[model samples]
Target chain A: MISMHLTYDAQKVYMKVLEECLKASSIEYELNGWSEVKLKGQPALSEIRTFKNKLREAGIYVIENSRHELIQRTKDTISEMILHQEDLKSPKLSTYLTEKLNYSYTYLSKIFSEHTHYSIEHFVILKKIDYAKKLLLESRLSLTQISYKLGYSSVGHLSKQFKKTTGMTPTAFYNIIQKRNRTL
Target chain B: MIRGFLKLAVVEDDKSSKKLFQKAINESTLVAGMIFFQQSNELLEYIDGPQNHVPDIIFLKLDPMVKNFLKDLRQVRKQHQLRNTLIVIYSSGASEQLIEDTFVYGANVYMDKPHTYEKFREVVEKILKINFQYLESNLNIENFIYRT
Candidate 1:
């Protein structure tokens, strides 16, 4: 007999349950990130009530605070920009955020720092580097192509930022990944 | 010939445990120096002072009995200078919720406190050998915890 309890990925389950709740409420929404959902428009209080009730049954609670919601929106926007490569067209991330969120960049950044304990610029760098790692692992793009895709002016610029965020150069990082694959 | 190249800091309060930790860290070839802090505030002050001393890796003892254990973890992460610094949280037997909380709050690694000094040295050496920069980039719940 198999004598063990089955385990499931909590994040996966959370996402599934969230989608079910949204569908049940007939709310049009987009999953911005693992933890954020972007609704098409303002959700009515009754719709929110039902959604909250469904999520509560799954042990998930909606963040009710406006500040927390704003933070999530900011993170979602940043993640979307980086993962989708939407920033390539935008002249500046600050201006893009100001226009999209209708809040001054200064105010958005200050509140973001107050809550997350890191600047928005730092967060963007981290996200971009993370996306770069994904692209590297996929092995579909060259380093120069990745640099251009991430909107870096030059390969040297991308390497500099990558090295700063991660202690090793991109080539070094790729070598480690190769070594790990061989070992496995 | 040149060992002890890695700077380490330990936030531990128990006197006997501190001695054991120091002995294990001293035996590790990768550790060049180690500092012991009986309180988290002392470590924070040391890191935040004008001198700007930041250790490569910090071993934080997570004890529920201790007040502000999670708060101290967050405080350490708040330092911009410590962004690249690795935080290894060790506990005798921490709850699942607490361990998850540590990860969400930016701890790079979670370890179970080893009973034997030999095991402690081994753990220290193994942790130092791993490239934390790569680990940090690919961090997830599956790889967050360290096991011997």
Candidate 2:
């Protein structure tokens, strides 16, 4: 029964990921957001790639069931943390992951690194950097406000991390964004 | 049919549950708009803060993490003078005593979170009918806790 429930849930997630991908594309598809989605035609590989990348850019991690379930949960939890910026502040990342995933932080870290070829901390930093990039482009919020919103201890800390990850300072990215917008 | 356009707010932490609920609600034309909140704090903030769209009905999922969620919800309704808003507590399971306490605290209805998609749609439809049609027909204070 437990396995049945788990399989059901995995299928549900699989359906949702497909539905999201369909919605992201320009092609129309008939979906009730449940059951199998009926597509008008097969999407091109490039179109599928774009859709997948879009989901990733939004920090929505959709994993295959054939892979380890733990890996999927870990990725989902991390993505959720990054997507919902509110959770970034409290309990610390390790503590939050432990409580949420119901596994020891060490165990989670080991599994995550083993499967993903990146440390959990590295993954979180990448997600944070991704979120920071979005905030810079999309909102009029000040650097300090964005820094605090993403749970950085200080603006300087955020900048240092941002620079380290993105190969450009946050302000420099913002300036480039501003210039591009002006040209458009 | 529902008498008028409805504004609804749902406070459910689980992403899958929230998605299912929203999908069910989207099938109906009765609702004009809906707001989704994932936590008690966010819900409280929205209700307390300046917002033009005060929901006609609110569906809140009980979370063990928020010990004072029901109490705070009651206070929000009273303090904000949202006396006419119908508050529904959605839980998979709760003791009778806890259900009674929620009723005493200002919840207008209690419903179990249905497992199947069809049941979820049915629950939403039934609640809307009972609350809007029955209550609006005759503002009866007696018809409160709904169970299934």
Candidate 3:
């Protein structure tokens, strides 16, 4: 669930309208909210179809089975922290997530991996690199300054990974994109 | 027929699925009312507004009740007096009791999206047809009730 805050009225509107429609159609559902709640995995297949029809009526966008849940969650965490304060590093990221969400690092890691097929640490690295990509494309920061800003120990380390993932060195990417923009 | 556009709202969390839904809806000439929200709160806000841009339907790809989703609905019931905002809860799976609880908390539609897009389109068509009839009769009764 995307969680920041939710008003009571929205929740009521969802539950009330959804309940009335599905019951009439005799299609069972878990209206309370959980994208991972799979009706086919639990209910009969034909019934699931009828139920889905009812949802379309309500304009309730239902997401079937999937694991982008974790990806979105982590993005929210990153965006929130970065928006509020800058200069956080990955060394402390695991601990921060653990503390903020109140789950053991092990449990979060396991669930995230099982669902997403990506290790939590790798996901974090990807996010940090993503942040670096934004800065490189959008900001005037020097590579050394960006390395320090992203908590990389040094510019060489940042360059090695940046080139590996993006297929261009930071300077090369910046110049290339800039030139492309000029042409446009 | 309302004969303008089919107003629709999609509330799903998965990015790939959401993209597909948007693409499908955009390509379809049948849908006139198309809006998208990734989370519940945004959809809820639209439902609660003064003009209440209530989509003719709302598609809620519910997440697990990690935070008491039922409670959220009950709160809305108390606050908005919102009526007829069709809510469809689509998930991959659920239990018998959980399914029952969907009604207990108030869901108008419940669907489990299948693997095939053909089946998906079939499902969308069927519901649109049914609701078109249902809404027509429903408006009459609602008018009778409200007038009294």
How does each model score on lDDT?
Answer: 0.72, 0.67, 0.57
Per-residue CA lDDT of model 2 for A1-184, tens digit only, reads 3554333577667667766777869766786656435456655435545876876765555454533577667767877776676555564788878989899999988876544545778767766776777777678888898888887889999999887654456765555445434332
Q: Per-residue lDDT of B21-55 in model 1, one digit per residue for the tens?
A: 87776665455578999877899889888998888
Candidate 3 residue runs with Cα over 4 Å from true position: A1-184, B1-4, B49-51, B75-81, B139-148
Tens digits of per-residue lDDT, candidate 2, B30-125, equal 566789987756766776777545777888886545789666666645645456678888887787666656655666667877778999898787
Question: What's the lDDT for residue B127 in model 1?
Answer: 68
Least well predicted 10-residue stretch by lDDT in candidate 3 chain B:
B139-148
Per-candidate fnat, comma-separated:
0.00, 0.00, 0.00
DockQ of each model vs. true complex? 0.04, 0.01, 0.02
Candidate closest to the true structure, highest DockQ: 1
Q: What is the interface RMSD of each candidate, in Å?
A: 18.2, 26.5, 26.7
TM-score ranking, high to low = 1, 2, 3
**Which residue pairs show backbone clashes in model 1?**
B4-B31, B4-B32
**lDDT of candidate 1 over A72-165, digit per residue (tens):** 7887788777765634674589987897789999999998765554578977887787788778878699989998888888889999888776
lDDT of 3 by residue, B30-137 (tens): 466677776767777876778857566666665565477655544433334345545566766766455435444555445666667777766665554333433422
Model 2 lDDT on a 0 to 1 scale = 0.67
**What's the lDDT of the predicted structure labeled candidate 1?**
0.72
True contacts kept of 1: 0.00
Candidate 2: residue B11 Cα off by (Å): 0.7
